[model samples]
Target: MSSTRKKSSRGREGSKNRRWSDRVTKQSNALDLESKIFKSTNPRRIALSLKRSAQASKRRKGTPYQSAMSMLNFYINRAGKSLSQKQKRVLERAKDELRDVFGRK
Candidate 1:
C-alpha cells in the first residue's frame, strides 16, 4: 500500500494578513447574512432583516435574537476604529431596534 503525505500549511490560507475572525464573519456556520446588511442607514430595516435571517437560519448556534445581536456586535467590534461615526451611530441604533423587534425591552 502507498503511504499518504500530509498537507502543507504554506499558501493554504488566501492572504497573509487574513485573520480567523474575518473568515468566521464571512463564512461561519452561523446565519447567512444579507449582502452589505451593515451598510444600511435605516435601523428598523436592519433589525428586521437581521430578525428574518436569524429566524430562518437553522445553522445559528444561539436563539435567533442572540445570534442576530451577536452578529451585529461582532461586526461593530471588528470594524473598530475604521468605522465612521455616522455609520456607527446607525448600527448602534439598529441594536436598539433589534431589541424592540424581539420584544426584549
Candidate 2:
C-alpha cells in the first residue's frame, strides 16, 4: 500500500537527519545520574564483593605443588608412546623434580 510505503520512507528520513550527539548526550546523562545516585547510598551497607576469610583460605592452599604433580602425572602417563629417548629422559627428570618439589620422595 502507498500509506505503508510512505510510513517507511518517513521513518528512513527521520533516522537519516537525526543527530548522533543527541542520543549520545541522553545516554551519557542517564549514566551520570545513575552513578551519582549509587554513590549517595550508605557505604557501610554495601555488600562485600570478596570475603576476607575465603581469600585467606585460598592463599593457605598449595598451588604450585598441585600443578606440578598434575604435569608430572600427564607426562608419566604419556611416556610409553612414540617418544624419542632424549624426550623420555627429559620428562623423567621433570617427574623427579616434581616429586622432590612436593616433598613426596
Candidate 3:
C-alpha cells in the first residue's frame, strides 16, 4: 500500500476521535455548570439584576415617565433572554406601545 492510503486511514480515525472529543467537551461543560450551580445558593445573575432594578427604581423618583421607561427597559432586557416565540412577539408589541406612548411627548 502507498503512504497516501495509510494517511487516509489515519484521517478516518481522526474524524471519529473528533466526534468523541466533541461529546466529551460538551459533557464536561454541563457537569462543570451543574457543579457551579450546586455550589452557590444564590445565582449571581439574578442577584445582580435585582440590584440594578432597585437602583433604577430609586433613581426614577416615582415619576410617570421614569416608571414607563423603567418598564420598557425591563421588557426589552427580558426579551433578549431565552423567551418563547409568543412572548417575544408580545414584548415587541409592548415596546412599540411604549415608544408611541412616550414618543408623543
Candidate 4:
C-alpha cells in the first residue's frame, strides 16, 4: 500500500514539473524588452528604443508598431498599481511619441 501511495505521489510530481516546464517555455518564447524600456529617463528616447527593439525581435507577434505598443502597454499595466502619477504621465507621453515615431498616428 505504501509503495502504491509513493508511486501516485511521484506521478503527481511529474505532472507538476511538466506544467512548470510548459509555463517556462511559453514565457521564454516572448521577447523581453523591459530592460530597454526602463533604461532611459527621457520618454522619447525610451519610445524610440522600444520601437527599435520590437522591430529587431523576430519572436514578437503582430507588426512592429503593434508589438512596440503592446510592450509599452504591458509595462504600464504591470507598473500601474505601484508607479507614481508623474511616472505614469511620462510613460503615457512616451506612448504618444512612439505612435508618432511609428507613423501609427
Name the top lDDT candidate: 1
TM-score of candidate 4 against the unseen true structure: 0.65
Between candidates 1 and 3, the one scoring higher on lDDT is 1
The TM-scores, one per candidate, come to 0.78, 0.31, 0.31, 0.65
What lDDT does the true structure give each of the candidates? Answer: 0.86, 0.37, 0.41, 0.70
lDDT of 4 by residue, 46-97 (tens): 7888787777889877888887787677667753446777878888899999
**Which should have the higher TM-score, number 3 or number 4?**
4
Candidate 1's C-alpha lDDT? 0.86
- Candidate 1, residue 58: how far the Cα is off, in Å: 0.6
Candidates by TM-score, descending order? 1, 4, 3, 2
Candidate 3 lDDT over 35-59, as tens digits, reads 2211222333322333344344544
In candidate 1, position 35 carries an lDDT of 78
Give the per-residue lDDT of model 1 (tens digit) for 9-105: 6665656655666666677578887877888999999999999999999988889999999988988898434789999999999999999999998
Residue 72 alpha-carbon offset, candidate 2, angstroms: 2.4
Q: How far off is residue 53 in model 3, in Å?
A: 16
Model 3 residue runs over 4 Å out of place are 1-59, 78-80, 102-105
Query: Where is model 3 poorest over a 10-residue stretch in terms of lDDT?
Result: 30-39
